[model samples]
Target: MPEAIHIRPDAARPIDVAVGILMRPDGDVLLGQRPAGKPYAGYWEFPGGKVEPGEDIFVALQREFVEELGIEVLSGEPWCCVEHVYEHAHVRLYFYICRAWRGEPQSLEGQAFAWQGAFGVSPLLPATIPLLEWLDRVRYAQPS
Candidate 1:
């Protein structure tokens, strides 16, 4: 057997860009709050995590669903990408519109999760608010 060598982080902290699944069912979608003791604690946002090297964005989203949320991403399409500059580091978010899936949703990360209608959830984190607005179709895919 060969050992799987781990690659170091881009920065001392890490540089992670990931996908957030807007899992839609019956015309609504699910949102999860970042757990306490974490970077974006108490902020309601889509469920996802860090992207690994050599990994494609879509595959990362599917894997994240299985690992972090204990669900399967039946299908999704590329939605939008967002870049946020936090004090600690920068993150580029790739969001997708989950078109289909099965099984009940669970928060494997032990964070709070919610299902809200398009444009329903609010008071979310500044980073994710734009995504919510996109789900709401508040504006076109890109700002005019």
Candidate 2:
């Protein structure tokens, strides 16, 4: 017989993550593949990381971008937030639209990355799927 496992209630609490959607002037956005040895490794998603305790989301965004992609975020604004539960953990993703940044993005973490006008990559992270749909709606919506 297989052994049963237990999960603590606090373990189900959603983790806060700051997600940076680095948008170029031409409407392209940046994405990066998850590095090997991380959760969701090899899956593509927007560049960002966990929000440290008491840390501002924007600060977290800038730090993560620099650490992961070597870009310094210059201008950005909060866009939206979503919560999702994965086998790994429950995450509350705070999405941001970064309009300005300094330096060209370099993959500092040995992961592949690209600027995409249309996200054509396969094996997108599950948490990012709905965010993509929302992006499409915003990008293609008729202006008032």
Candidate 3:
């Protein structure tokens, strides 16, 4: 049987996160597995991190890409925003679509990475699933 998870009543306040959907010209997007020892370890998520106090979302996105994936973001367009409440923490994620970047992405944090198509990738972080669905709807929306 699996161990039951516990949540403390006094969990820390919600975190502001900047997330990047690094998209290739071919319409695929990059996803990385969370490193062991972190919350939601092993689950795949868009490459990003917590937004430090007073940091702009764009700057945070660029910094996170370089810090986490070793790539310098050339351009990132604001895509969407979502908030989710987890047992341990609440997070407000600012999602960006990064279509341009320098250097090949390397997993500097020892986490696994993959380029995934529009659908069928499994076991994504709970927060990322809705973003993917939103992307699909926006990408495939019928002409008015």
Best of the candidates, lDDT = 2
Q: Where does the lowest 10-residue lDDT sum fall in candidate 2? A: 135-144
Better of 2 and 3 by TM-score: 2
Q: Which ten residues in a row have the lowest lDDT in candidate 3?
A: 135-144
Best by TM-score: 2
What is the C-alpha lDDT profile of model 1 across 1-144, one tens digit per residue? 999978544334435666665544455667888788987678788788788998987888888888878888877777788877666566788877776666778877798788777545555777777665557762223222
Per-residue alpha-carbon lDDT of candidate 3 for residues 70-120, written as tens digits (9 for 90 to 100): 999998878888889876688989998888899999979999999888555
Q: Give the Cα error of residue 68 in candidate 3, in Å.
A: 0.7
Alpha carbon lDDT at 46, candidate 3: 88
Q: For candidate 2, lDDT tens digit of each residue in 19-113?
A: 99888767788989998999889999999999999999999999999898888999777889999888878899999888889999997899999
Error of 3 at 47 (Å): 0.6
Off by over 4 Å in 1: 1-16, 118-122, 138-144
lDDT values for all models? 0.71, 0.86, 0.84
Would you list the rank order by TM-score, best first? 2, 3, 1
Clash number for every model? Answer: 0, 0, 0
Worst 10 residues of 1 by lDDT: 135-144
The TM-scores of all predictions, comma-separated, are 0.77, 0.87, 0.85
